[model samples]
Target: MPELLYWLDLFGVVVFAFSGALMAGRYQLDPFGVVVLSAVTAIGGGTIRDVILDTQVFWIKNPLYLYVILLTAILTIVLIRCPKRIPKRFLLIADAFGLALFAVLGTQKAMALGAPISVSIVMGTLTGVAGGMIRDVICNVIPLILRQEIYATAAILGGGLYVFFNYLGWSENFSIIFAILGALKLRLAAIYWQVSLPAFQIIEKNDV
Candidate 1:
């Protein structure tokens, strides 16, 4: 289980780093800026989760996380000769994958630490969306979590399903796989179909 979590964490880090680099490219940030954004977006949520859980931050304990982010950023720079222009859809897909992997891994970690199911669900959702939130804020855009899109909703649903499956005595591997796939499916659907939750609207006194 630990080995599976480790590899999944690495996968999430790489995908998240790629999304961050793509964002930096969109902003035409310098190489240093790109690296910083990539690192933050790759580990920001995990850092927060660890701090809140009173555990060692994952990247702080594992230098491989940093190395992965750096390499990912460098590769992005090399591949995208023109930083200012890239397909937005590619970034969205990558972000969805990262979100799915991180959500499952975070829930598993929280559960392993004996956190309550509710707390684990929140942690999972946070892990999935917090990094992207930070990245969007830094890039001067509205964070997806705050938008109408099915972003954090997917994470929360996936986390709930994971907990439910575990409670039903399912195997850890099966629960994890189902959770990740479920989250990814929902997120990708939202992305491709522009599915979104309804927004709140305030009516002015004059209109009323």
Candidate 2:
């Protein structure tokens, strides 16, 4: 189970790093920018979670993560010479996959650290979205988490499902897979339909 999870984590990192590099490409950023963005998008959330938990950052503790991110970013740069031709769907699909995996993986890690269930869920959501948030902010784009979108909602739902499944004595792999699918399906549905949560509004006191 542990070994399986490790592989999944590495794959997730590659997917995420590719997505970030693609975004950098969209902005016509140079090679260094691509690598920097890729690294942050691949490991930012996990780094934040580990720091908050008072643990060594995952990639720092194991250089394998760095190697994968670098390799993925380099490959993206090579293969995507004209990034403008890259379809928007590609990034969205990559993000959905990364979100689902990181959300559940982060929850599991928090649980391993003996965090409370509530905190674990929050951490999971953070792991899924925080990197994207930073990436968007740095690129001068609005972060998806701040939008009235179903993005973080999907992450929360995945984290919640994983916790629930574990509590029911489900096998770890089954629980993780089910939770990832739940989040991925919802995110894809939202993207297909352009679904978003209703935004909150307030009436102006000075208005008629």
Candidate 3:
């Protein structure tokens, strides 16, 4: 079980790392900045999760994950210099996959730590979105979830589904596949239809 989670974590990190590098490249950031954003986007959530869970940082304990993140970032930088334009559409697809992967991994970790379902869901969403949020902040842009776009909500739905299926004694592989598809569908649907959360309304002040 531990080894399974480790592999899932690495896969999620790779997907997010690519997404961050692509975004940084699009913004024309220098190579160093690109690598920085990729690292943050790949590892930020797992760092937070480890801190909150009072465990040794997962990536530090497993250095291969960091190595993979760096390698992918550098590879992405090379792609930026290619003559062909990289499709922005692929970034959304990568983000969806990353979100789904993190959601299930986070939920499983939280459950293993004996957290309740509500807490597990919150952690799962945080794990799914924290990296992207940090990447945007570092890149000096609005967080993706705060935009009029679908992001964190999709992660939450997927994480909830993962926990529900697990409680039903479903196979781990089946649960993961279901959660991943749910997240991808939700995100793609929102992107295609421009669905978003409600914006905050300003309250009028009463004259005394």
Clashing pairs in 2: none
All candidates' lDDT scores? 0.90, 0.90, 0.83
Please give me the total number of clashing residue pairs in predicted model 2.
Answer: 0
TM-score of each: 0.93, 0.94, 0.89
Write the residue-wise lDDT of candidate 2 on 18-127 in tens digits.
98998898788888889999999999989999999898999889999998998999999898876548777888788888998999999999998999999999999999
RMSD of each: 2.0, 1.8, 2.2
Q: Rank the candidates by TM-score, best first.
A: 2, 1, 3
lDDT for position 111 in model 2: 97
Candidate 1 off by > 4 Å:
82-85, 204-208
Q: Which residue ranges in model 3 land beyond 4 Å of their true spot?
A: 1-4, 197-208
Q: Could you say which candidate leads in TM-score?
A: 2
lDDT of 1 by residue, 33-102 (tens): 9999999999999999999999999888889899999999999899888664667698889899999998
lDDT of 3: 0.83
